[model samples]
Target: MKSFAPKFVWFDGRYVRDSEANVSVMTHAIHYGTSVFEGLRGYWNSKNLNIFRLEDHVKRFRNSGKVYSITLRFTDRQISDAITALCRKNNARQSCYIRPFYFVGRYGINLHVTEKSPTHAAIVMFPFGDLFNRNGISAGISSWRRINDSSTPPLAKMGGNYLNSILATQEGKRNGYDEAILLDHLGNISEAPGENIFLVRDGKMITPPSSSSALEGITRSSVIEIARDLGYDTVEREIPRTEIYFSDEVFLTGTAAEITPITSVDGKPVGNGKAGRITQKIRNVYSDIAMGRNKKYSRWITPVY
Candidate 1:
């Protein structure tokens, strides 16, 4: 995987070189993981560039900050504008990923937070391609269980919560799997390390509900809407682990994962072990919409130039 090396990063209240952006070692978010962030994708189509769901991503970033008590000084629109300006400044005329994050910069070990706690926000954009192999990926049912809401809010895109994901993903990689599917506290299917899981059975699409310890993914929401627009039935309910083994198709959705198909689970092939017809259709439609090729879903995009 290539590292992000953008020319300029929107740091604090100004655009600075990537080398100039730095945070204190004692920053609360660095030590205690007191931070919230969001990921967005920008697609370059021919001569036009557009960001997918820029407003929605910014709104979620603000909401995530609120949950962690890390208040952002800028409004949602301001943050969105900053991201657009940063992307343009970088001259990113290709598919790229944008990460907007706000973190606690106060130097302290105290658990108690206050409004005076230093909060810092930055937007970084860089050229990015498929996070996972396009052919398909193999997955394993991880031994690690998803953390419950009582432990930490799963809905919030917090930095600390990713520790659980790190463990699960590492376990998968060590065991010769492309990804890990984590179960909830009650041994029910939750989601993947960095994406939401969806299964297709008998031509119907189903995914775990919000109560199942899955992060409410923006791409996941987009998939559901696109599926409906394509006249496919979608359902949100509790999915058992065994259901994946028998499902006809399995895939993951997220800003990074996009719509990656999972051909097998725990060494068992899903149906014929290839991307299902419905999954391919949804993927194509999503790609078209994200790249500004679909006029019907153009409202979902925010053009950068």
Candidate 2:
């Protein structure tokens, strides 16, 4: 599919033509990956564009920068306002993906980075649809192990840390799987390359905790809350790799992936190889809340239009 490029991007506290939102080739983030980022989704319901969990995403974005000593020049409020303004400026009339990131600028091949280091920030949005096959997708256990806090801190959305995901995803593609699921250092299920993993068994939703090297995903937390609110039990525990193969249903969640089902794992069908009923229910509620259809969870959405 052809990618949809936005006409403008928010760069360094101002809106700029996408082509002008450029950085130097010698940028430190380019060479060393000393950057942090976050992904957000905006849903348009024909009348209004609502950004899902805007405050939470901005808070995490700032905290991600703090984890790497990349201090942002703008306050959280400023960043949040810019995001909404950017969506309005783009005239986004459909569901879109938003990316907000900051990176260490050109300080000339320095290994030491600090809060005092020069940094550049940018926000970009593109008209996007499903990141994976929403009906269902196939996955495989990756040979690559998930990075943990002991090494580079998996909880932080650092750019450098994604190399592990990149390699695992590439391996999955080579093996003809739609995606890759990774185990933590302890050989326990962690998460998918970019999304958190969840398995349903005996009518309970279970997922690995951050201790298992899973990123504390916003969508993951939302699903847990939504599930409990819907009278289903939710759990966070160290899940074994075998549990995925045996679960009644399996799914992955993220700002991009949303709540995509995993129909098969390691070529084995997950609960008859289709999106489970419970998974569909939660996904429906999530979509409703995101698209401004559920007024009860109105606080979770920020209207841009």
Candidate 3:
């Protein structure tokens, strides 16, 4: 499952060897975690001899930087070209994860926004694999709650926000669970460590809105649209913890994990402890789209060759 790492990298406005893409010790981002990034996958497509969802992911990469005050020096078009070039350079035409990070290069403790300091961007691709341990994982309601929006910037994909996720995720791993279902300050079901939550009741799909302490996920919206197309009504609103235990089914979504069914929570089975029918349908559709099996989204794949 291992992939090659570039000896050189694209950094500080140019592609340098990885050994040369070094950051300063005093870098603000290094000291305070003042960086933002995005995770996206380019799925292998046999028909196109490339990977899927390249453009959508690159767009999010640019938007993620803008939210964190990391002015992407390169235009969206430029970033897109860079990703394509990197994939072709590495001869990666398979399931691969692409991470684009933007950080403050020059170090300091100014604590204030520094638009003048050097900024850095890098795009790295690696072999992609299952994010969950296995299919239909049993999740648990974490004692650790999500960080309040006031405590950290909620809209940006900043590195600091992940500190909260780390705590919640570690809590679950210690408890022998696949993942953590984080609640908001007011005790409403928020989201997983990295994915959005969905609740199923009476055959309808309901999820917490962004105001309910959920990240506005790109894949979340896609699931909503796909669910509607599948004839299931979808609702985005505040969901209570009580609803989770009582639901017929539960699931999570993200760019990395896509859609994973949760059969149990807190040691209790969700609707009979098997993956729900609707959950299976959506998972199949998502997989098909990502693997280049869906003609509807044939345009989403970008051929590396």
Candidate 4:
């Protein structure tokens, strides 16, 4: 989905007009990708917008910075407040995506970054919608292997690490696919370019473990919890590539992708080549939970009026 042009953004410590929220070309993050970021979604109900899983996203945002020694200038609570305030400042009345990030700034040509290094933080929000076909989409098994913990920690949502995702996505699009499914170094199912993968067989949900190079996705965890709450079993293990072709259902989960089913993988139709029953059920319930329609999951949402 296209992001709406925002009117204002939270830059450093205060809100600024979008045009004024600027970064230098020589910034450390631009040159060396020395930045950490997080993306969370806000859903608009009839009354107000709800920022889904704000606290969890903020905690992960902080952890991502810690992995790279990029300490944010703001505390977790301050960051969360900034995200909510940015939404209000932007007059976000529709569903939107929120990005809270910190980057190494003005440390010219420095390979070794320390906590004392200059840094900048900002929060931006814009109108967003479904990233992919929520009904179902085709996927290609990308030749690009996922970046592993040995080279870079997959758990950390660092900007440089996404080069791997970029390559996989490029290859997938070139090969006539809606998204890319990358395999781990060992040729096991890892995840989509920007989302986590789940396989259903024998009425159970299966996904690759974080050890297999999959990010510990917040949406993936939420899907597991929702599935288990619905009485479906969930498992985390290394999945062979061939198993996906045989699974009863396959879907991807992320803050952006949400819960999108895979109707076909590499031209082979999955199950009946349509969104599966369980996937539809989970997606429906997830939409409700995120949109403030499900009071039982009210704790997962923070309303921004």
Per-model TM-score on C-alpha atoms: 0.97, 0.97, 0.92, 0.98
Clash counts for all predictions: 0, 0, 6, 0
Q: How would you encode candidate 3's per-residue C-alpha lDDT over 30-128 as one tens digit per residue?
A: 888878788777776654445556676667666666655666677777777777677667667557777778887775676666556667778777777
Query: Over 4 Å off in model 3, which ranges?
Result: 1-8, 47-52
Ranking, TM-score, top scorer first: 4, 2, 1, 3
Angstrom error of the Cα, residue 183, model 3: value is 0.3
Per-residue lDDT tens digits for candidate 2, residues 137-246, read: 99999999999989889999999999999999999999999999999999999999999999999898899999999999999999998999899988899998888888
Worst 10-residue lDDT window for candidate 1 reads 1-10
RMSD of 3: 2.1
Give the whole-model CA lDDT for all candidates, comma-separated. 0.90, 0.93, 0.78, 0.93
Give the TM-score (vs. native) of candidate 1. Answer: 0.97
Question: What's the CA error at residue 11 for candidate 1, in Å?
Answer: 0.5
Report RMSD for candidate 1: 1.8
Model 1: lDDT to the true structure: 0.90
lDDT of 3: 0.78
Supply candidate 4's per-residue lDDT for 50: 96
Which of candidates 2 and 3 is the stronger one according to TM-score? Answer: 2
**lDDT-best of 1 and 2:** 2
